[model samples]
Target: MIGSGPGGALTAWSLAKDGHSVTLIEAGPRLRRPDFGQSIGHMLASYFWDGGARTSRGNVVFPTMQVRALGGGTVFNSAICMRPLESALERWRDEHGLTEMTSEMLDPHFDAVETFLNIKAADDDILGRRNELFREACSELGWEWEHIKRFEEGCVGSGECITGCRAGAKNSLDKRGVAEVVQAGGRVYTSVHIDQLIVEHGRVRGAVGMTVDPETYERRHPVRIHAGCTIVSAGAIGTPTILRRSGLTRPAVGSALRFHPSCYIIGVFDEEVNPWFGATQGIHATEHLEKGIKLEALWATASTFSRTLPKRPKQFKRYLKRWPNMAVWDGWVSGDASVGDVRVLPGGRPDIRWQMGDADLRRLQETNALLCEMYAAVGAKEVFTGIVGLPDVMDPREAADRLREGRFERTEMPTASNHVFGGSPMGTDEERAVCDGWGQVYGIDDLYICDTGLYPSSPGVNPQLTAMALAHRLGQELPERY
Candidate 1:
């Protein structure tokens, strides 16, 4: 097993439970609780892939965050738990020959994962002003808003979910799945990088790479192992790079990337909102997602908050003064048909390229306007948007009108995605899929993938739960197949 994220961790734990000797190789260091802090930069530098500064190499330049630590994204995410939408997964079943996946079929697996992670909805007492504002706005708009489930049992509402949980309330893979795997006699190797799959006699035997030094990140000891089977459970970014480096010519091995490109808007209130005292995203609007537009209450540090601020120093500082009262709403929509790709660059690193279609950009604009209306309804003093030419939208109606017909050159809009999937999609179709229904790489026996990269398309929601569910499906079925 390669990678120790959600999909990787769950798959490893299940395999170990079935008496399969598994060696989980993670490309990052094993960080203990004391290593984490409120410093986002410190978290990124220590636990993230490429120090969290990686960007796509094209016109649609944006930060592509990927955690390379012991638990992968489970270590850094907001712990939001969401099942795959039946409406979206059904499309994959019909088009991608994914008969193994269905919401009904995965109900037990979802329940099991929820139990293992101790998933629970945040109670009203733990909610902050931002959550209250979102709930009130959703009620006024008659849009559905609910307490999102989190893998936290006794959360203290630290508002540092993205940075790394210091309170130890979060059930990240290291504390749950990986810990169980270790207790079950499974071996997990941190700071070990697996570069290529070792194909022997037309079958994957194992993998080879080098152990990286935790301090300098320099390749240390060479590594080679032989196993009965190899599952590439690396993340969406890491999995595709492995396939390309192994000389897989299938176009789908490193193409057809999908993401939920996100934008943000801030609401300035009369009272100090201090939006950094609760979960990163405790309340959300998903009921009226006819166009795949989702809204969630969000707050971040000055660096993260600066992403949507005006570029000019003077203008940016002006908003910084009112940061105490600023509460942000993160809006996201599905990426359009203008697909993206992740190719292996020199030295076997992944390079991303993406461009959003005009329709998708327009949908994001519409969502932005809708958030403005919500903030206005809640009596916000000011609405600050990240639109290129426009900064602050003081009037809700004017914001709606201008966003509907604004000259938003998509290149200028800063966009990022938490849910990146579909580089190595699952299907029987040769042209569009890199693997079969059970995550068996086409034409490569004994090699499989159990990660978000197997997603045929973006689920348009939180993908951590979806990734684990799919990995669980693979773990249950692969034993039978082989």
Candidate 2:
């Protein structure tokens, strides 16, 4: 195991439980309560990569956020556990030649993961004021929405989903996969960085990397180790970087990066609607998927809310005055047209180049405009859309016109994605993809990649469930000869 995230930890646990020796290496240490402070800067230093890592193309830098600590992004993510929609699975099978993705093949794995992780519906009591307002607004507009499925077991609703859970109720593989692997005699090494894969005669031999000294902050230079098989679970970005550094070049090394670009709608109400008292990603509108949009409620801290307020001093004052009456909602684009690339940089850092296209940009604008209208329908005194060149509360006619006529280019769009896909992608043809249906690298023996990178395309939903399902299926099919 070359990473300690959900994919890596789960892979190690599965292999070790099957009576295999495994050594899990993590570049960062296990995140503790002190490391997950209220300060974003402190949290970034401890869990994130240099205030959030970025990939550059020419002069424009595209920012991507990933958790570098143990448990990976799940440590700081809102615990929204949704399986990939059936429509997406059918599309993969009918259109993408992924015939094995049928429900018959997937349901058993889903059941296993859900049972192991304890997936359930979010409690309505913990649904914050924003959720109440959102439901009311959706009802008024005759829109269909659903409460989110969460992976938390007895969540106390501290509303600190972005920060590492102090309650330890969030089941993001740390308490499940990591615990199982460790208990089964597998070793997990923290603060270890892998530099390259050791490939010998078209087979994965092992890997070499360094272990870091926490107190001195110095690396001991990664030591080499041999294994019969090597699985690349370092995530979409990390896995591709490792492969590229090791001189493994396939046509689809780092291509087809898709991100569900999202924007927030801030609604100012008359009554206190503290959104920070519930699941961060609970309550979403999936009805708009056919229309290329999805709406969801979000919880944010005061600092994050303050940062998103208008820059003008007067606007800032107004925002603070109505802080207690504010609620945040999310709008996500559904089209799979945008493209981003992940490449290895000069200093061995992973570089990403992401930008949206005209159609996708237009859809995002439309979605944000619709959210603003929905907020107004729900008796919001004022609606704030984070889109440029649009009024805070434009009328329906004005909103439509502004959204359609907006000249904002793809590069000008505000974008950031925690959900990443492609790179070592899976497809029928080896020439078009790095991995096959079994997640085996086309040309290498004893080398498998069981992670989000195997996603053929963005499923327009949380990738964790699909990732785990695929990993389970792959593990079940591991070659006996190995």
Candidate 3:
């Protein structure tokens, strides 16, 4: 296993439990529970890729946060556990030849993951005022909504999930799957960066990289590991770059990149929402899912939230005072029309280029419009749309009207995405997909990819659960096949 995220950790644990010797390697350090609770800046520098400054390159530049810690993104994400939509699975089957990836085939694996991780809906106590307001808005609009299922056991609702769960309530894979793998006698290594694979005679024999200091990030020594079967779970960007560096020059190696581009709207209510004290993301609505949108309540630290405020000192200070009364709501668009690719740069870093299609941009506008309407229904005094050329603060109805008209260009809309997919996508056509439906690399023996990169397109929801489902399925078959 060439990563320790959900896919890598779960697969490693599964194989180890079945009496297979497994070796898991992670590029980032293994963080203990005590290492959390730091400021957002500190956490970003220590845990995020490129110190949380990594962004996609193309017409519009926006931050694309990718975690670089043991347990991967699961360590930092809100632990939203959403199954891939049946419509998305059907599209994959019809368009990408991923017939075996249906919910019927993967639900058992999902159940196992949920059971092991204690996945459940956030209780009312943790839903904070912000989440409750979202629920109220959804109810008023007659839109379907539900409490988000999360991998939390004893959550305290500190609203610090993105910075890492300080309470240790989040059931990140590091504490579950990776820990179980160790109990099963699997070898684990952290702060080890693998750049290339040892491919010989069309089979991956092992991998080679350098060990780095966990804190300083200074290179320490070169290391190599030989394995009978190698699984690359280095995530959407890392997996494809490693393949390309190892001379696997197939065109499909780094193609078909996708994302859930999202943005948030701040609704300033007369009553104190206390946005910073709640489940990081507790409630969500999928009523607009067919239109490629999903809505959820959002929360972040005061300093992190301040960054999105007005730059002028007086105006910023004024808004800062209103923070206690603000509720932030977020919506993401399933970026099916948008596409991108990952390429290994001349310098050793991965170069990601993505272009958001016009249709997806319109979807973003529509999402903002819907959020404005939701705020209006909930009796918010004003809203912050964050759409360029529009007033920073406006009446909810006015914002909705302007946003729904789609008067802005792509560049005018600010967007970011943490949910990225594709690059090493799976399909029956060897020439088009780097891996088969079973995650086995098409032309390579004893090598597989079990990550979001295997998704031929966007899953249209939180993707971590689906990624784990795929890994679980691959784990069950690998021990039998190899």
TM-score leader? 3
lDDT of 2 by residue, 50-122 (tens): 5565444532234567877777778888877778877777777776677888888889888877777788877
lDDT of 3 by residue, 329-378 (tens): 99999998899999989967899999999889989999999999999999
Candidate 1, 432-467: lDDT as tens digits: 898887788888789988888888886767788987
Worst ten-residue run, lDDT, model 3? 300-309
Error of 3 at 423 (Å): 0.6
As for TM-score, the candidate ahead, 2 or 3, is: 3
Order of candidates by lDDT, top first? 3, 1, 2
How well does candidate 2 score on lDDT at residue 456? 77
Best model per lDDT: 3
Off by over 4 Å in 1: 310-318
Q: How well does candidate 1 score on lDDT at residue 376? A: 79
TM-score of 3: 0.99
TM-score, every prediction: 0.96, 0.93, 0.99
Question: Which residues of candidate 3, in runs, are more than 4 Å off?
Answer: none
Q: What's the CA error at residue 237 for candidate 2, in Å?
A: 0.8
